[model samples]
Target chain A: MNKKIKQNIAFFVFRLFSLLIVGVLISILGFIAINGIQVIDWEFLTTAPKEGMTEGGIFPAIVGTFYLVVGSLIFAVPLGVMSAIYTVEYAGNGRIVRFIRMMTNNLASIPSIVFGLFGMALFVNKLGFGDSIIAGSLTLGLLTLPIIIRTSEEALKAVPESYRTGSYALGAGKLQTIRKVILPSAMPNILTGIILSVGRVSGETAPILFTVAAYFLPSLPDSIFSQAMALPYHLYVLATSGTDVEASRPIAYGTALVLIMIVLFFNLLAAFLRQRLNKKLKQH
Target chain B: MIETKNINFYYGDFHAIKNISMKMEPNTVTAFIGPSGCGKSTFLRLFNRMNDLINNTRLEGECLIKSKNIYDKSIDVDELRKDVGMVFQKPNPFPKSIFENVAYGLKVNGVKDKKFIAQKVEESLMAAALWDEVKDKLHKSAFELSGGQQQRLCIARALAVAPSVLLMDEPASALDPISTSKIEELIHQLKSNYTIVIVTHNMQQAARVSDKTGFFMMGELVEYSDTKKMFLNPDKETTQNYITGRFG
Candidate 1:
């Protein structure tokens, strides 16, 4: 065959491979929707599970997941954003800075199970928190810290240097410049990073499994020290370790569907925020 | 008045500005003319310490304004910057409304009175000769303005803080001839109030706007004299050649 024909065939193969990945994603989504859509209802969402983990809803799990996400973000976002600003804006390229950056990158690649073990040892046992919401939240926060810091640093770096120079030349101090100019410019990207971390924290089961996940909690958690039922762990228990795995299959699919929907909702919210904030920035 | 005494500058041991000395009178326009990489722009930035933002840059010799050394540790850099405003070659209006762009300097200085900020913004815009065109659209984004208008907006921004000195680093180099002439006209009008130092590659522009002219080449001051004499009867052979279009 000639070169042009060979190139066309190669391009066709690449396109097919790309479509295959999308096809797989759609197939999985379709399978879950078919199996899980029937079991979803308002009552199912607002009430606790009934009759030996086979009947009612995943309400406690939903509430527990919400609390966990909020708790993690409260612990992580400020610390992550501030650390990013320090690295990107204040810290010069010195040995310590390089070492910190290297450590963060390494942390990002560690397996989720390893993070769970670390969390179990540090927050759960050593801190005497036991299997509690705070332990789980802190663990998830640790799991997501590297991601948030890296993304936030990228966002901060994306702001043009001209803006900083302009602010400084106008006699604005470093803090004022960051608060008024740099933060505003980087807000949308930081929000994006937070949304991504929310997705990761919500879907993660291994980290919460060792740190805080309860086998079956039908009621709402009253305090940070209470063991919680997160969606991922709930789904995992319903599928694998339930008294009747065959009967609990629908509930398992329902939990998975709700988790996916929650993630999708947050992603949509992030997209909306990005659009609004970008418009505001441009309007100036 | 501004004076530099035997100033030598380096970028990490690469001597970028050789020993150069010059004096500038207050409320007069002094222009530096040089080819690219000749350190004319670098010299202009030294007035406001803009070069301090770059790393590994060092300066020797006193840069005094109004008989006070600005680079002294005792002097506040922010206060010094407020006293000395700078406009760059490119029109860098912040991504803010035209009104905010002009009012930025005053606001940063803790000026919270709304009426005062409004009045100062107007006065600065008027001084920059951009008030009439933008008066009706002050709330609009600064990016919406034409390049020339944006350049004038930046000038107005610099003027808002009421600085005694204004440094223009090839202010009109990026502009069209018509915009360039408008800027030149504004510079002429501004000289009655602020000390103006401009760097330009356009020799004609230097002659048109400046009262005194300094020629720089290869990071050294080649000639310094009154603009009329510098253009008419240059003392140095190199200055003569440069003016007569022999070489940069």
Candidate 2:
């Protein structure tokens, strides 16, 4: 019943929780940095793919991963941001709006593999997109859409009500406030959503295998109609498809490290943007 | 001039404002003074139809601007908002450059000429008494300003569009004494070019700045008279008791 005793207990619990989170992140970072850097090489990064089960490089896969992420961003940013705008700004608490909200929440929790399956059925087969870069990109786009939408919705929501009031008071229309005030304010968060989705897409294998097809193509796809290779699919091949995997062990760790690095780079970018925005926002 | 006649509003079957009617003169300042939940804000919001966003809310009466029924179905809500600007208790500047924040109104109303937008932004800032502090940093983000500066920026933003009526909801409530006085002086100067309706709980602020003051209590307009009469010679004993700090 002592007040000091209660306060001390609360402080201890807070420190304990903080330590738990920091401990986990530090452990993961250490493991990835230690295991991944040993196999990473400039040759591995620059060299094109080879036919030998042990001699091949992940260049095509890396390139394909880039295309997939860029493609998905192209597909998702406009639609995701627009949907968030509609939900936050335009549509009120109506049945149609509720339905859209319900669907978006449902979509967020569905596994990436399910999205991959959906992509296979819809784009690769039903829609006749085939096992091309476009199909894979579309599938990945679908996979990332929910994440982008949810995170972007949160970002848009976090913009203070005063900003909206200020814009509205200025005689700006609903769209004008959203476009000029709301969206710009929420942009750093939206960019984080895009970066996170890119990480998820680059590391996924099962989805790409079904839609992108695991062919050792000599050249990059010249058109959307052309099939492509990706880093995750190549890792899967070297690890499982009876390739020279004793040597491929380092390659897998190296590839994992590369994926982690790319994700970290984007994460760093998001942090930088958040810091800059916060410094400016604190003045007012 | 803005006027409301026999206005009644309900929120989900609960009466929020009942049979409220008043006329606000042009080129002067009016203050809405009342306890919380007395519908001063609701009444202020009605001028620009900001209550349209509220769910399951109903209205029955006429809100007129210059004798034209604003509630008439054909009236464009967007155009009306352009003429009647509002400011909230807290300062909220866009995460944009000072120039952009001031230019936002002109841009929204289809003014695309960059030269015109630049000139209007300057005039609005000058009108709000914030030009000197921010003139050199027009390109800096509006959010980089201090709290008082942000509030003034908001005023500039509203004045940029040349709105005839300015509805300020406790604009100085969030400011320190110095900032609050600056806003009061700005409001005093602004009344010459724009009709101003300010809502305040501070009796001193209402007495100091308002030409006419409306006292609201329990969703009713208890007193509406010249500020001098309302504060000095009281008609209703309830108004007298309130002014003397008997009850909020």
Candidate 3:
């Protein structure tokens, strides 16, 4: 009715929406923790499924997910950081650089299911790796590549222009300037990008679904060629397609909780790393 | 010695530096005083080829240092820069220790002996008049120093490469009066070994530290002469007006 009332109403609406998001997040976490906490123990975390996906911990799946994450990071981190350095530093702001940026953004927007299918055709079938850890990792790496590149580019760009000029003024070449000054300055933000990619790569089910995920694996994957049970896919099978979905519901919830915890751990690690790097860069 | 013969520079389509000629003798301090956007800083940067870092910039005419045309295709830019060091308006030390900031030049130029680098760092800092303040904390971060100290650190960084020429682009504009005086004193002391060219907005600073003075306006060098002659009895009316603070 009046300006004060209108402003108050707008503030109330915005506050309500923000609180609603927190409420939804808490309810989801609360639901999973309450349902799965009783089932989780050292044995549940360390042993394989025992009775047709109805008992025992999702140990093989957890190990498989861990391996897949490490493999993807190995494949993606260097490639992504290098690509970002090229696009941001070497390429200059030209038509080709603009095109590369556009393509990266487009790649980020592409469906994860499309990546899964592509991985199946390329790494799994054409490359003849079949359903294996390598294929799955390569797929997940592709899925995370755009994220890493974009974030790394931002990190590199955030470095002050004065640093580049300062390095150049001291008779340093471009490569030397980048190596000695730019990279160290941008390292914190670049590491943040890598950690964020790790979080996203861990929870993704689609890209790894056709490439390496197994409906049931008796043991952990021994090599890159072996098919492995992954947490997201294991949870999917337990909740939706297992022989007794109701019987495996608690295990499915536990798997979801573990996946969430892994993501949370990485997020915390990113924050911790950023703080440490900022302090080190600012002080010693 | 540094000389520019009728040099003109363009930033894309805009003429940023009109035809200008000047000579700076070895071991003498020459100051360019001008209003903002007068291209004094741009003209100063030409000696080190620092302007080349900007995109779509064009230069015509010759820029020479020590009788050799630095603008020649045969000249290696990195080598040119090694001989012509530049200090910027803002003190830009890398995110590194005080010692490392000074040693950066030597490290990048492939100087490997740790003992030699350490020696050079101390000498450069001493020359910059910052060694006594930071000598106890060489390994400490450069950001911990005061702004004036940081500016001196930048000068130390520039001097560490053993350049024969030094370019100061308003090196004391961002500092307090005490720091400004310290930098000006440092400039005076440094003139015996390095040919220094400084661009200053502060006219008194130009008169105090320079052997020669050049007044620039609208991308043109309006007057160039001995500092005393230029300040007391300028040959041009515009120079007189600018020096006397009649107008920029």
- TM-score for every candidate vs. truth? 0.97, 0.90, 0.98
Worst 10 residues of 1 chain A by lDDT: A275-284
> Which sections of candidate 3 miss by over 4 Å?
A1-10
TM-score of candidate 1 restricted to chain B? 0.99
The native-contact fractions of the candidates, in order shown, are 0.59, 0.63, 0.79
Which model, 2 or 3, shows the larger DockQ? Answer: 3
Judged by lDDT against the true structure, how good is candidate 2?
0.84
Scored by TM-score, the top model is: 3
lDDT of 1 by residue, A136-193 (tens): 9999999999989999999999998878888888888888889888998899999989
| Cα RMSD, model 1 | 1.5
TM-score of chain A of each: 0.97, 0.84, 0.97
**Pairing residues by index, what is the TM-score of model 2?**
0.90
What is the C-alpha lDDT profile of model 2 across A7-41, one tens digit per residue? Answer: 99999999999999999998887786787777668
Scored by DockQ, the top model is 3
Superposed Cα deviation of residue A194, candidate 3 (Å): 1.7
Ranking by DockQ: 3, 1, 2
- The digit string of per-residue lDDT tens for model 1 on B1-248 reads 99999899999988989999999999999999977899999999899999998999999999999999988999888888888998988888887899999998998899999999999999999999999999999998898998899999999999999899999988888899899999999999999999999999999999999999999998999999999999999999999998888986
Residue A100 C-alpha lDDT in model 3: 92
